[model samples]
Structure formats: structure tokens, C-alpha cells
Target: MEMSEIQAARLLLGGDGRAGQAASRQVGQESASVRYGEVKSVDAEAGTMTVLLDGQSQEITLTDSTASTRLKAGDRVKIVKQGQSWVIDLAGGISRALDTAVSEANARMGAHDETMAQQQAAIEAAQAELAGMDRKISDAVDTAISQLETPDGGNHIYAGADEPTPPKDGLKAGDLWYQTNASGQIAAVKVWNGTVWNGYDMVANSILVAGSVGSTLIADGAVTTAKITAKAITADQIAANTITGAEIRADSVDVNEIASGDIYCKRLTATDGAGYTEMTGNKLEMLDSGSRSLVAIWVEGGVCYINANLAEKISIGTNSGSVLNISNGGFIFSSMMPGFRVNGVSAVESFAIAPGSATESFSANVPYSPHKTSYAVVYYRCTYTDTAGSVKFPITEGGSANVVLKELTAFEAADESIALGCAENITVALGNSPNKTFAITRGNPYRFAIKPSGNSVNANPGSQFEITQVTLCGQ
Candidate 1:
């Protein structure tokens, strides 16, 4: 027999015996009961409400509970809805349910907003961290590129400084260096002098580059004018005479005491045989003056050489004995000569044999010998060393440095191998006249003698010959 507040309101408001009717009508109907009235008086201590209706005021008893709403004398409110009954408004069960639902909804909204805010903050933090890492990685890559870009040229020392040389293939602010990578790439290059890292750094090592052919270490485009020693010159590096970035000007260069234009400057001080010879050019200002007699001549391609007033021809191979024997008539004359003989001051010199002498030609031809063929010979004694040697001048196996004399006694006619041979000693003999006295010795100057074997009438036409001087290491 528990009654809801709506039932109680029905009992209080519906006529005393009309409860059953109100309840029956409200069973399936969605409705509420309300009354219009004015508050006449309120008693705080008694917790009661006195409302006026139709000029009459009635005192109402309030529930003894803290959750109930208190009304003042002039305030107005509605009671809870009841079963088909009209009643005055006041705080009741309906008000409590609404209050609870509104409070729960507000708490849930606050919690949801806080979670969303936290998630947004986390996303922003992650983005900032990623940006910082990107910056660090970029900086690291830039540093690596700079380190790799450093040059690897040979080292150059300053005038008066005591700093240790930089790594051969590493970065250097001031020093001379030339180094390459495994692929023959120019990895690092540096040259340091007294003041700055420019101009005075382009001094060549030995008038030649130390890299292999097609290596690109000292190719044509690698050198420029700013790296030359002379600061006032219009152009410093000659691309045509390309070395490395350290190429010097052709006009201002000297190699082994021989100037660029084959002009003799002084006695060459080298680890091999050294001497000087004057060469007159048939064409004035030829690319090669043919004077220095060094293998590395600065001659342009497709140039012609005309030896005017030259007599006798001497042509020989690079691999053969030195005895160039020419026999006919009565004796055998050999062209095997010595090491150092003054070119113009030798008793035996090469000259074109004049025609007409048949039975008695000058270097007497042995009768019924090896035909009337002409011959030119050079004596050679090879010595090799294996100690401290240069690439161009390699050491031999004896551990006592020496030279290689590829013997070429007979002259070739055309397109012959143009390489030279080195010689330190030579021996000769003439099987002819009863008093054939030809002396041979070392250290004494000598030059190859060019002579024809057959009679002057039927000599080898165009008796051309070549005699290469073998320069020894530590000579």
C-alpha cells in the first residue's frame, strides 16, 4: 500500500471520494495536475506554505526534508504532476529526477572535453619533436658533405711554420698535398704557403704528374690561372701542358736545368747522365728545338724535323747487340762505341759517305763477308738498381741501381718504336788492318760512329740511324 507522490496529490486535491475516478482516468493517460494561486504567507520555522485562492488563504504543511524547495511570501512555483488532479506547484519527486539527470549530463560533458584537450596537446608535442629531429639530421648531412668535398692533392708546406701536415686525403686549411681515392678520383687537395691558401701553391713536383694515364687527376680542365706563382701574368696555367691543379706556366718553367722551349739554362743536376747540346731549328721557333736530348720533349704533334748539312745516317733497334759490323773489300768495321764522347770533338763521327769508292772505301769492307749491306751500331752495358727509385727511373734487382741498354745496332727504315735505352758501359773491336788499334774504356767521353758497310757506289740509300743515350740512376 505504498503511494507515489502523484497519488498523494490526487488524494489531497481530487474531492475526498473522487480518488478512484482520478486513478482510473490517469492509468493510461500522460498528464499532470497544476493550480494557479498566489503565495499569501510563508512560515520559515514551521516550514509551511500559505497560498491565497478565491480571496481565501490556506496553510499547507511541507515535508520535513532538506531536499524540499522553500517558498517566500511573494514567490510562486508548481507542484509535481498527479493522476488527473489539479494541484499547486512546489518542489516534489518530478523536480528531483530532472535535477539528477541535468547534473549527470554536465559531468559527462566536462570529462569528454578534458580528454579531447589532452589528446590535442599530445599530437602537438609529437609534431614538435619530429621537427627537431629533422633539423639535426639535416645538419649532420651538411657536415658530411663538407668533409667529403675536401681536396686530396699533394702536400705543400709553408715558408716558416711548424704545424704537422694534414691527412693525405683529408681536409686542410693550409698545406701542400695530392691524394686520390681508390677509384683514382681527386679526393683531397691542399697547398699552404706563408700568407694565404692561394697563388703561391701551384709549384709542380718534377715537371710531370705522378698519376696514371686517363686518371683525370691532372687533366686539361683541372688547372687554372689563379694557382700560378707569378701573380702579374695574364695567364698562368697552360691547359695545353696540363698537369694537376698545380700546373705552372710554360713560359716560366724549368725542368732539370732545361727551359720549356728546349733552351739550355745550366748543367742539369740529375740522378742520371747529364749534358747539354745546342740545336738550331730549320723552322724558327719550332715547338721542339731538339736540344736538351731528354726523352720528355715539349714538342707539338705533327711537327717536321729537317737536319740540314748532316752527313751519314745511323739507325738502330732498341733490342740487339751493339756491334754494327760493315765488311767488304778487306776489313770489318764495327759501330760499337763508348759512353761519353764529345759530339763535335770525336775523331769518329757519322757523315754521309760520298759515292765512287769501290774496292777501298773508308771503314774498309771485308771481302766475301755478310753482303754489302750498310750498318750502324751502338755499344751498351746495362746496370740496374733496386734501392730508392722513382717511377720514371725504376730500380733494378741487384739492389745497386743501374740502367737498361736495349741494344739497337742496325737502323730501322720506317715507323719504328720511339722509346730510348740507358747504357753505362760499351765495348768495341774492328777485325781489319794489321794495326787496327781501337781503345775502349769507361768514364772517357764517346759518341756513336755512323759508317756504311758496302762500297760508296752501292751503299744503303738514305742510311738513317738513331743512338739513344741511357741515363742511369745516381750516375
Candidate 2:
């Protein structure tokens, strides 16, 4: 058994039981010694080395078999204590220390290489990603260039700038180009028409040359009246019947423009024998030189006829007889009037009235004056009930029963007292029964009245009467 140096030293210094036992068990044994330190300095001739041990300086002697000559400052060495002296251990000394250090250095170098390899791989991946990004950027730039530049047709698609000059080569038909002229000025744009280049003038205020007016060049409503010369539109310029009545402005067409035979009328005079002949010319002259009268002239049978009076009688329709005539005053018809015309002042009394049990009279106020000589006719229509035994009669003042003829002067007369009678000169009848209408010569009363016969009539009190119409007329 051998005692380690630490145990022997502890026992020699009066150590505890564990160290004392270790020394006692190997009292005769040699002490095993080993120490490790970095060599601080070395003396080959003296076979001694100054070493740093546990942060303290120590001098150790090398044995005859030790390689102390190979030791240098900063070298790590393992030493053993022998007989109160320290010496490098040959079995596990600087060689073993160098070997352990080499192994550790190799491991660190291996770790550093792995880290470098990882970094290299990361850089390569980043480069590849950057390459892809560059390719995308290049593609985007190419696409942008394609959009901005002209196409194969060599036409400049962009506007509001100077046109491209000389154009791109290999241009097809309809390719447009622009270039400086001989005067070194930008010339008109030219279009390639396969065989030749045709200049297209886009200058403002340029006049359209002859044969240049095409349908595509003219917009609707582009041609206005101001653009046309006076009388430039002739009869041939207008399509047949295209000008409707509404399109013709009022008084725009002169009389000279109207054809004479186009004025068709059934009559032109008031007299039956006097009528217009057929118009022969295309012109009608209406001239009034003097202030006396206005005249209308027409052409018939190559003869011009003039008429100053348009109101003469004329035959119309298939009758060849005078059906209508117009005088200076008005119109007259030989037969019945064409339409009912209001003759004179008229009034309507359309109110319901209840007559008394006794005979009573009803009259309409006349607003018109009587004719001095000629007879004025009064027209009236009334509705009333005639009792079974009652006798009703229309009458005027100052007339006898059923036989009076002269006109009455009184405006109002009693019904029962003055039993006036119908005028003999005037015709009276119970037209349409219970509704009577009659005409009488006008007199002073200027009002019409209806009365029941006082002597023989027994009027019904509940009988209702109404005067619907009254009119007066005179020649």
C-alpha cells in the first residue's frame, strides 16, 4: 500500500482520524505525489521550473528522466512530490497535457467549422431568395416597358405629346408615324397605307379639300343654316313631300312659291254665276296698290283674272245652284240657313212656378226695344198643366178674347180682370200641348205673358208652370 502525499502531509501535521488511519495503514509505504500547474518559468541547467499552482508561485525540480527542456512558460505540466522536492511526472506530464489540449483545440475547431458551414448554407439560401426577387423585378420591368412603348404597328398610342419620329421598323399598313420635315419642323402625321405614306392634316383651321367630304367626316346637325348660302336650297334639293306642314314656318313660303292650281276652293264669289276658273300658272298675285280695296288675282286658261269682291254669290256642291251667299253685310241663304244663328236679344226663364187657384198670368221681362215700323217678333215657349175643365190662353194687353190683333202698350196687366186675348195678326197655337210657343208682333209692353181665361177657366192651384225660352227678332 502507498500513502498519497495529501494524506501523509496531513498525518505529519497532526490531521484527523481519516488521514491518520490512512498514514497508519501505510506507515512503511511510499507517498504517492502528483501536482498540476502552468509553468511560469523554467531553468534547464538547474533542472528547476517556476510554476503557478493554485494561483501561487512554486519552484519544482525535474528528474533526470523528465523532459524539462521541452517545458516553457505558459505550458501546463503535471508534477509529483518526491523526498521534499517536486518533479514532473513522466507518465502523466506535459505530453499528456499537450495531448489533452490538442484534443480540446480540435473539438473547438470542429465546432467552429460546423458554425461556418451553417452560416454558409444560410447565405446561399438568402442569395437564392434574392435571385428570385431580382427575377420578379425584371419581369415587372419588362411588362411595364411593353405597356409604355409602341406596338408592332409603330403607332404612338399615347396622346398629348409629340408623336414618335420615323416610327418603328417593320411597320404594317395603317401604321402612323411622324417626322421632321425638310424645314426641320415637325410635319403632319402620316399613315402607312401599305404602298405609300399619306399625310393626314390635323391642323386647326384647315379647309376640307374637294372630294374629302365623306359621310364619316360629317356629324349630324353639323351643317347649319348659317353655313348655307341664300337660296342655295332649291326645289331639287328637297325630297319630294318631305317638307310637312309643321316644318314650314309661318309666312316663310311666299305666294310666288305656291302653285296657282294648288289653291282649291269650292267657291270664290257670292253670286252663283260668278266663280273662279282653274288656275293655270304656278304663281298667284295678291296686290293692293291703292287704299281703296284689296284685290286677289289668279290665272285661269292662260288668262289672268282679278276680283275685288270675294263676297259674291256662288253655287256649291252638286246642285249647281246658289246654296250659300255672302254679302258685304253678312251671309244669306236662298233656302234654310246652314246652321241655327242667334237672331237677336234673348232671355231664358227656366224657374218653376205654382199658379194660384184662380186664373193668373206669368210674363218674361223684355230687355230689347221695339222696331219703329217693321214688326219685331217675340218667341216664347212655356210649360203648364191645363186642368180638365180649364181654358188657358196667351194674351197681350188691349186685346179682346181670342180675337185681338193690335199690339198692347201696357207693360203689366192683371190676369183675372183684364181678360186679354191673342192678337189676330200673330199666329198662336198650343204647340206640343201644355207646352205652348207663339210669336207676336212687338209692342210697348215688351214682355210676354200667359193667362188663364177668367170667364170659363177653373185653374188648379197645384198646377206648375215654367217658361223655358224667350227670344226676339226683327228685320
Candidate 3:
């Protein structure tokens, strides 16, 4: 039974009902108790409640039911007595309590559902916005790629072409096309410089100098920028220093010029075919093919005169002589025909036999048996005369009249003394004589007599003597 507070309060305070005594003193504790099964209809206006117990319903009075003393269905009512009418029940007590709980639970569920719906809508909106932005970004990328044109008539992409397909010419997506020299080598790179397309450095490869593998020659390029030089130029030096040794070897230099030490060729022969003197300064001159004269000179005369000009100097000794004869004994002779003499006295000397013409053949073995048998040998000696005058001697056969000196003995003994016997001090000396002297008379028969002088003089002119043959006896 549901009971109103007014009815229960009247029962407890006034002791007006049968159950009043039972409920009265119990009020000092907390709320009064009611039997749930005994509840009947609540009467909110009468402030009392009826309850059924033991199959019978009754009206029980209560002291107070709360302020206005009204009750209704759904209110939580209580029966404070054993017999209480439905009017004494609390007003709408059970119903009101159950409604409040149901309302509160519905409100919370509604709030949670509303909040979850909002979150879902927000997520959907964000996804749609992101999809639209992706489309715009993709459109911008396409515009950028279309603006660029590669050398092979293709577009350029940042990372790569769409779908990463190779270019139509099988080139990389961002790659440019250019011509190469059949070696599959990159001739040059034509790339974009942010504003325009331009070619990077393009240069022709170099060739080695002929016959020189390590040497190099550039066909064309700016030497200052191309970095060309001789082998002596180190790699680091080439990079650091200015480029030099820049030349085009169209034709070789003259061999004569090279042989004469006029020009230098680094990697060419000294006698190159193009007349080039492949002479190089501070470097070696090498042949293109065969061997060559490394350090040689070409002489043009009949004799190769390397040192000073001693053309007419004779090599005279006790065993050798000059090729030509001088007028006087003490002189140096030459080999030229009708030769000349240097540093010789030529006052009155005559040829052994008159020359083939004015020129005498001082060649070997063309005269009478000469004391100096060799054509080159002749004797030299000085003489002192007691008369203090010059002497004269004839290089002829010694005889009284018609005489023939077959040997040296005949020539020595055939000396006819037609002069006075002056003295041993009165001497007749012999100078360089190619042929043996048959007769010699120093003085005239009317003056001082002749004498034999043992003094000696050099026949070779410069400090030497020569004897071709030895003759012991005078004819």
C-alpha cells in the first residue's frame, strides 16, 4: 500500500486508528514502514490511504502526508496501519518515483546518442575535404609536368613520369636526349637551369701522339679550359696551372733542321719523313718506326772535321812524314796537290827532280833512291861555317862528270871534292831532304874549302825528325 505523509503523520501523532499505536512510537526512528503488497489506490486530497491485507482492504488514518496532502497514481505510497483505506495512501508515490527514474535514464541515453552522431558527421566531413585537396594537388602536379618538354619530345616529371613508365624512346622519365659518337657514351647533358635548357660542357676526346702512347694531342678545344699539356705536366699540376703546350701538328718539321739542332720534336723522329725535326727540348726524340741516330750530326765534306781545322797539319815523327814537301827542310807540309807550306824557309831550294810541272809529286817512290826511302821522311840538320858565310848544296848524283849512283854507297862515295880543304870546323849540314844528296860543295874552289858538320836540325819543322831509309856509305 502507498500511504501519504499526512495520513501517516496523523496516525503516528494522534493515535487515531487501530494501527496508530503501532505506528506512533515508531515515528521517532527514521521513516515509517509500509507493506508493499497491502497498497491500494492513493488519495492525494484526503491525505489518507487504503491498503489491503489478508484479502481485505481498509482505510487507515495518518497524521501527516507532506504539505498539500495530495497523491496520485505512480507515486510511492506507504500504509502505516493494519487497516488503511486507499485514500490514505501516498499520492502518486510509486508511479512518480518510477517516472523520474525512467526520465533520467532516457535523457542520458539521448545525450550520448546525440554526441556520437556529431562525431560521426565530423569524421565524414574531414574525409571529404581531404579527398578534394588530393584532387587539387594531383591537378597541379600534372600542370607542372606538362610544362616541361624533354629533348626526345617527352614531358618532364619531378620524381618520374606517371605510373613510372619509361619514355617512348626508352629513356628515363626526366632524361634528355642527345647525340653521342657511336660509343654509347654521353656526349653532353642538356638540362634545365630553372629558366631554360642548356648544354653542359661537350668536348672531343684526345688522341695520342704518333709513336708515343703516353703523350696526348687534342684536336680542338680551348686549351685554357680543356686542360691539355705534355706528359711532364702532372695531373695535379694540370689542374692547378694554366693550360699550355697547345699546338696542332699538321706536318712535321724538317729533318735537316732537327739534325742541325734547330727545332725540337717531342714524340717524333729526328729524321721524320715530313722533314720535321722531331726534336724536343728537355725531352727525348724518338723514332716512329725503326731505330735512329740518337745524338748525331751530319757532316758534308770529304773528311769529317770534328774539332779545330788542322787540314794541312802533318803528322811527322822519326818514323813518319808529311804528304807534301816544302821548299826548306824545317817546315810543315800539307796533302793538297801543288801544296802550300806554313812556317818554312824557301829561298833557293829546288825539287829533287823537276816536278811533273811547277808542282812536285812528293808521293812515295817517284825519285832516285832517296836516303829517306819513304816519300814522307826527310832529314834536318844545321851547320856552322868557319868562313862565316852561307853554304850551298846540290841534291844531285856525286861524280867527276857522268855518274850513276845505284845505291846510297855510290851517292856518298861519288862526292867529288872540287873545293879546298878548309877544316873540320868548316861544316856542310843537311836539312830535311826527301831524296839522298849525291854531291854537296859548300865553298868555291877559289875560296875556303868545304867541311863536314855534325850538327842536327829538325826536318819536320815543329820538333821532330824523319828517316825513310838508312844509307851507310856515300857514293
Q: For model 3, how big is the CA root-mean-square deviation? A: 34.9
lDDT of 2 by residue, 1-475 (tens): 3345564344332333254364454432333355566777777777656555433332333333345577778877666666775566655764787799899999999999999999999999999999999999967754453334355644432211244334346545655554455553545657666767677545433344355463223334343221333744555244343343433544233333544445555323323333333333554433232222344566768987655564354323336453543334333332332212223322111121222211223333332323211111222221232211112233332222232222222224554433222222223221122233333322211123344442333232221322222222222
> TM-scores, in order shown?
0.19, 0.25, 0.19
Stretches of candidate 3 off by over 4 Å are: 1-82, 85-99, 146-155, 158-475
Give the backbone clash total of model 1: 49
Better of 2 and 3 by TM-score: 2
Per-prediction tally of clashes: 49, 6, 80
Best lDDT among the predictions, by candidate number: 2
Once model 1 is optimally superposed onto the true structure by TM-score, how far is the C-alpha of residue 146 displaced, in angstroms? 3.0
Residue by residue across 232-285, what tens digits does model 3's lDDT show? 543322233222344635443322222333444344433435322343333333
TM-score of 3: 0.19
When summed lDDT is taken over every stretch of 10 residues in candidate 1, the lowest stretch is: 383-392
The per-model lDDT (C-alpha) reads 0.37, 0.42, 0.37
